[model samples]
Target: MKAEYENPFRPPYEFLASGGMVASGLAILALLEENPLPMEIRIGAAAALFLTALVRGRQGWKVFQKKRRLTRGKRFLKEETEIELDDVREIARKNPKKLWIGKGFEWSSTHRQLMKEVQDNMDETKLVGPLPKGEQSKYRETKGAVWVHGLEEEKNEKDIFIPLPDLFGHLLIVGTTRAGKSVFLSLAIAQAIERGECVIVIDPKGDPDLRAAVERACIAAGRADQFVWFHPAFPEKSARLDPLCTFNRVTELASRIASLIPSSRSGGDSFVAFSQRALNAVVNGLLQVGTKPSLIEIRRALESPAMLEELTWKALDAYCVSALESYPSLRDGAYQANAKSKGGKRSKCDIVIGLYRQHVQPSKPNTDLEGLISQKEHPHEHFGKMIAVLLPILDMLTSGPLAQLLSPEYFTDVEREMINIGQIIAQNKVLYLGLDCLSDAMVGSCIGAMFLSDLATMSGQRYNYGTIDDPVNLYIDEGAEVGKHIPFIQLLNKSGGAKFRITIAVQTIADFAAALGNKDMATQVLGNENSWIALRLRDGETQKYLADNLPETTVQYVMNTQGSSSKAGSTEFDANLGERLMQEPAELYPSAMFGKMPTCEFVGNICGQVVKGRIPFIKREEIKQAA
Candidate 1:
């Protein structure tokens, strides 16, 4: 469409003006001639002048209309607009199959050029001073309207919507502080809740308004009972979530915890590897004794040799009893003989070790169980040093209410309900995980990372088996804090096939790089997301990152050259007037424009198309009514 449309500024105005002046001068000279011409000739010449003037006036009017259009377009673009609750309900009903992103339209190359034009031509001085009382009140009504003062638009302003299927590819929202990341999240989450999809929000900072918005969304959707809130600070009101509750293998649980240890660069891989092995050993022993593994239990087993001894003894006794039923009578006899004392005296561990060495080790051995007993037999002093880095992390997670929160004793603590990703998806529930990072970043990050690992495991399960009926919409606010975790990357990679729609919000790309300690790791995280919503980005690197993703465009500018020369007496004067069109390769949207965007306003690449949209402050009045 842009290619076919002629430039509105490109009309022959200069030529028409010159011709109009020349014709009027000729008519005057004819009228003032000393030898008057015939009346018919004069009248014909007068008609010719009139025709020239009319043509020139028509062209001038076109230029005027075009200028007005440019002004109207800018005003439309900057108008204070929002999506009310009634509008939301209407859109949901009309487009029952599509995803309503926000209220805006496709921002094409024409719009980009027009915005540049507006920026170059607008009067900056007029923008200063106090606004009209009514206008100021309107601006105060919503944060989005305040920043649209200088924004521009061309045409086709309407609601921004996308296909429901595009969500499988995932979405990434990037913005600076106080730049409406939470506002956009609230709207998106509300839509998902309204759609009856399973929504899981992982908010590290734990914005209270955002939590209220989700609660309101659930209430509006008539699914208030589905809302499950988990916050470490409010254990009495919060739900219990065991990150280690469900895993295909014990090693997965170990790897999930081990990932939190400092990388191999700071601490050698040997230390991390040993820590994982130690976790695996403890987890296996607990499973062998029919006990569910939890953070507190893992810490106790690692910190005390007595607990390890008890686990080993109980596991060995259970294995021996099982062996009597499964194996031959002779094997049972061997197990009984190994339980007897040696020459002087034998300890309980010694008897367990003897039975394992004689009966279990020779025939059929539980390699998982063997790892536990081997760690038990290892020199205590050396083993402690090997797992030194792993203990403190466990302690931080197990301390205070976190111990029961992360590791819920379902049978004993009946007040709090337990939540797992599998159940959250199957039952179509809304789970909001508030890590409360402001209070404790380390603990919050660890919990978030482990929850991501558990989510990754659940995605794997969905991928291998079959998908559930409803799609899972997962929103991770302040993603950079936990986004560096390996499981997060894995979740992004595997979530598509598992019917998961993931949206990650970050302050800036640099934050992710800083958290991951590598730029390439940050790139890896961003690469998995197919769509991006960029709000006011102040970081230079973040701006460049966004601009780099969009394809370059040709921007045309007019270059005018004027020259006049005067020669000696017999003075000859000549003037040459010429104009040229110069084209330069440029980003569709300048990197700096992102810095100037208003709150709740965004320029996004949804799927493949670009969009400039505004997210309204969705009302929660419906929450009160629904309640």
Candidate 2:
């Protein structure tokens, strides 16, 4: 074997060459001391030796230069470029074509350059403007351009920076697992908080990352007392409401469901309406006997002549009895038991976190029609009161004999009442519901839909004057898998333009689209998001979607590349060079797509101008240790 091959870790051949020169210089000096030469010749030889030594001494320096360039390039490419918030002109979703071509290419050249293009075309003047004066000083100026970060590679320099809007109506995020969706949501939340705005986080999966972030935020604001945990199964001990309140809430919900029947033209709608009306009358009539009616009193009222006269009243009596029989403890207010506390006046919680355990069958039966119906039943099996709330009264009404007479026209008032109740909850409180450990997908959807609808209703009423200007944030993590609620998305889309801002975290576009049942709507939601941060994505469709939607230069630089040819007709060639070409230059590309674990960064209008950066992500261990 060759000597160089024998010692694999030895210095390169260049080092050996330099060593030889040093040896030669020493030999020359040794010979000169022994043998006198002509003065002129000796002088010339001495000068040549000196020059050779100088060259040999600095031979290793060339390697350092190469390393320096690589380091500088990496830093320049990865460092987040600051785009002041003020100069932000507009923050709209980039068209597929626009994102594909416009992001990396320079107006004056065809060469695919990264950082140079960003530096050259970036609206430097807008990026570096005077800070706002007075109370406005508390708010940071909006970053005019969007920065793209990739999941796999160092941040690219050729990343696209589109002009951002001063104010975005709303933002929608969609992605699958580890797609950097949560990071994206955190970014938005952090920004919103920095602006001194309020935020309400609704996390169905009980993502610890999101929970920890919110906790830190509360602590930072000196408002830790505002955090509230609302577990339906475990009610607050301090809650002043009596058993009557529980019956009233249920009755009110039933009445609202009954009213919704008119909006439905199907058998299901009529059935639900009749059932809801009956349940409401039964529950309310029984409760009217005293402050809190007993199960016996409820049964007596159901059998009374006054109840039999109304079709809805009959249905209510049957459902109530059936529910009590199924869960006997409910008769004693077990379902509505309050939480245990030490007894000082509890803090007026600004955020209410709800933890509901959903009972969902992981695998559905393989039967045909029966199986389909059984699948729908899985959502209903959850323990939360929300399911009971959404269950149509029509089901109960149609079960016995009144099914034939039930009509949509009879339930209008019920539906309106439901909407009104939702509005009340949303308007009355700044609720931050964190639904932890959701096992079933449907339960998540139900929770998301119900709350989103409530928020939408309240937002529309201007019932509460809150927005990005004086905003409230709704944070959701792993939203697609945990919940597939179209109405919630629609609500978010609507609210983005209103006073509220919603942040959703998901793993992939496909998962979100599948859950939403509409690809276009999913695209609209994701695109409209003021900020989008992408993490490592392995799915082809997701990668394609990102490539198609990102700036053109970025797509070309990050996604398109030619295969390398073997050098000197040999099969082996340098793979690193090919990687370098394909690798997103962090300075040029702010976002990346390919890596073992990649992360993409984005910002838009919904985040508001003030929240450029201030999101926190503390680990559970860190929080515990700190506490």
Candidate 3:
């Protein structure tokens, strides 16, 4: 029978103390026996020593048994085995239980020297360069490597390194403010850049250190020109990041835009749906009219209620015409005079054919639907409400620097060429959007969410149509600012296979819940993420969230019992042992320990592997060297 226990019957400290007492008592009894003491006293002293020695010996035996079990259960020695960043497998659990893997570096006198030497090597580089000789030599070619942050050592000290491919499925990074999460994110981004992977990092705060690291990495890769930095406030100095650059379809793009509306934060209500429908009409209408409408133009077009109503009928007319053209037979009457003859005048088919010929078969798009809507021929009562829904959203975007961000004319800095998001990703280019939250968070967040949604939609289409073997990562820091973007949340489950990796960093679960507006829904989204790295959390909810993800074990206990029974004047002693099975709750990790986890330490569950590790320290000089 196997038993898992928090506190054993004979703990190490108690066993040691009892053993010491027994040893001293036995020695005194031996001395007393040799000193020719009285028979009664000697016998009594011997009886007490014998009883004491027996009790202590029993406890010591139990302690020795526990030690033996622990020794036998160990698969590898922490001191003998060491796991480097590259040594970590993409799937740790797939490796056999007997696999030789160790937690991170064992801290000792030698490791102290190792850390110091690593620091010295980092500082020695005057410019962006390779790792230290010793460190570089240990590296191996694999999927991709992040730094060796920490080890998982509870069951056995095993090295846990997050691989790039594993995160193609998506990663959720939860940490409070100043919890070293941003540092770890920087470390991960630096590693990806060093690996020559194209990465897009969205920083709401516009952190200088992170920007420097990205710049240094670009220099190291000799692709400095490939790096594009976009700051909304200073649009002239940065790359032009227009969300429309990734627009592929009218309906999808409208949905993405609708999700960015702050009013939709309470969940996609009637207004959100109406806004999406209205935006959809204008976008399709502009394309049909051969106008490459930017957000400014789209917003201007939607301001006219008549234009939106007209566009709606035009879209519906176009759809009906196409359906009839593809299946002309379906348009024929159900009861025809002859099998080969056209439908009768009594049939509705003739009417549809006439309308298609009049409005849809022209060489140019027939967008003259003002008469139809004004006369109340097609648009129902919902038309006016839908148009009203899109006005406020358009107002927010067409106001200030945010307007410039989506304007085609304002994006003329690239020699009148807009940045092609799909091409940038397919060709592998680093694009950084530095939207400083110090001024206003809404602009950065709304734009960032739109950009992410568009990219995910494009990537998913690419996966379905073309082959995408290379992975692309989206790093969004201060994710709370973006809030509940339904499109972005949907990407969590779909993008992994499309080679779209997203790492969302937020201050707390509460923030995420507030953004999502439903705590249960937010938790479901978090659970869908294949990997989670929690740094430190103060609230009990967040702590329990981490603890719930930890590993669970089945424990069996053997209860030993001894009892004395008295019958008449005689006494009989009996002992019985029974075995029972007990289940450990979903909460596997100790919640208390995680709440008390010091800064720079993180507990993560990645690809079915549980890990608790510390973020490796990078000195100020080292940061400068990397930069």
Candidate 4:
């Protein structure tokens, strides 16, 4: 391959050629001056030599330089040049004519010296623009503001702030276990509180420092009364969360609970469907007859076949009783049906009919207390299996403090109703649910899933029904620990308009896949969110997922070939620039670098832009002092 010559430095031959041309012209002029030749001859000769030397010298100089440069590779090239700039300070009023330039400094530098020329020609006030506005300054952060983590471009050390409304209302935060996820969480929580959006932090790990930071933000925003530590672990210090009581729609409640009940390969999909169906049946039964709806009641219904049959009959009976009273003609229809069934003997079914007619109230029946009794004919063969499948799940929900969490009335805190999550949204308050996952992992996860589902319901309803006006942010820490119970598909896709800004932090994609039961579904959940911040991911899937979000760019590659020896004299080395796209994760930032990013630094793929940034470091001491 032939060597290619680009821009090159001047060599001795190029300078000598340029000098020779001038020397020859000068020599011709000198000879003409010393000669006694005819004027025309001397002038013509000098002019011809001058023209030839001028043209040939210019061409020869370029050839010599290009040849020299081709022989030597670019080993010593200055990439940039820096120079000093001086500022002149003049006392305009006192002495206009006698101005003194200030001492020189190295702040200014330019590729072309145009800025230096401008500095000398124009009057300037200060070197840098007024120091970036303080992030915490009252003028910068206002009610309903969202603080974007890093700068729009890599220019300075300043926190960027955009209004909360500017975002699409969702975020996915992915990072390894100890990759400063908590730090970013703390920062977001702090700023979110300052922004005055109703903040609800569902932390499975029960972080105390996070609680303190939230308190500081509440204090900073002068909404301390709005700050509530919603610690279900210590129900005595917090409000009761009756999963059954807060909702108006019981079917939705059942669906939420069903969503939390994780499915397993042991049962297959049929078992999952059976549990959900039976749970829906049990919840509907409990809600219909008003038998103090709670997880304990559901547990009782699941444990006893007799109780389950009775509840089912009772719920159906209440509806029958109501229909009969509302239209007394139903009594005649019931009598006709009873007569048709009484041909054989006074069976349990007949006994049920007899009791209903005998105890029927004319104008009024206690809808809450009275219901039909289960007969021998009832209790379908599938009912027992459904109950069996649902028992352990109900047990999980009813175990430990979780059982106490879902009731509006509590043993310790009686005077004030444990404000439910819906109220938390409507009233615009900050709630921190510090689930003690470290101590009771299963119970904590179950409760977290339940609360997040309820919150997602409220968010979805916010737009469809126009109930909640204030923006709500759901900051879920250790989201993967919640398992497959969280209604991720619903939250990721539909919770935004209701102003439920979801920001979920997980350690890895594997954890999410574990929760989702499939990698594709896990990715779908992540895909719904508009913004993502991934820091130091060890899992290849997580790294690949994030790297995939980056746009493809054309990159130049060098192709080196050696020894093209057709003959002994034909041995050669060649280099060429080839361009192709960078496609794979390995071709991008190494997984190792991302797997071990420094604290506060993260690879942020947000709002259609990708950047590797740092979350301004905040110390625990600072939060403590501020608090």
**Which candidate leads the pack in lDDT?**
1
TM-score of 1: 0.84
Task: Give lDDT per model, in order.
Answer: 0.78, 0.39, 0.59, 0.58
Candidate 2 lDDT, 189-264, residue by residue in tens: 4344434455667777766666566555445444455444322222221111111122224444343233333233
| Backbone clashes, each candidate | 0, 79, 2, 4
**Which stretches in model 4 have alpha-carbon errors above 4 Å?**
1-163, 246-248, 264-268, 290-292, 305-321, 325-382, 410-417, 556-592, 621-627
Worst 10 residues of 4 by lDDT: 80-89
Residue 20 accuracy (lDDT) in model 4:
70
Ranking by lDDT: 1, 3, 4, 2
In angstroms, give how far residue 348 of model 4 lies from its true place. 10
Tell me, by TM-score, which candidate is best.
1
- The candidate 1 region of ten consecutive residues with least summed lDDT is 141-150
Segments in model 2 whose C-alpha atoms lie over 4 Å from true places: 1-191, 231-431, 463-469, 481-483, 554-595, 598-627
Error of 4 at 238 (Å): 3.7
- Kindly list the per-residue Cα lDDT of model 3 for residues 378-414, writing each as its tens digit: 3545555655656666677677656666665644554
Model 1: colliding residue pairs: none
Across 1-627, the per-residue lDDT of candidate 4 in tens digits comes to 444422222233545655676676677678875889887887777777677777777776665543332112121011111111100111211222221111111111110122222233333222212324552232221111011111121123232332355344577778876666777776666656655568889889888877776776666556788887867567667756665554556567666666655565523567566666566667766767766667787777667766766675566566555756543455455556666874764433344345454655444443332322332234656556644555676787767666666655534555544677777777778888888889878777777877777776776677667786777777888888764665656777787776667788888878878777888877777777787777667788777767666654332222334443255566665545543322121223333445545444565655765554555434433322223
Q: How accurate locally is residue 463 in candidate 1, as Cα lDDT from 0 to 100?
A: 68
| Model 2: ten consecutive residues of lowest lDDT | 350-359
All-Cα superposition RMSD per candidate: 5.9, 19.6, 14.4, 15.1
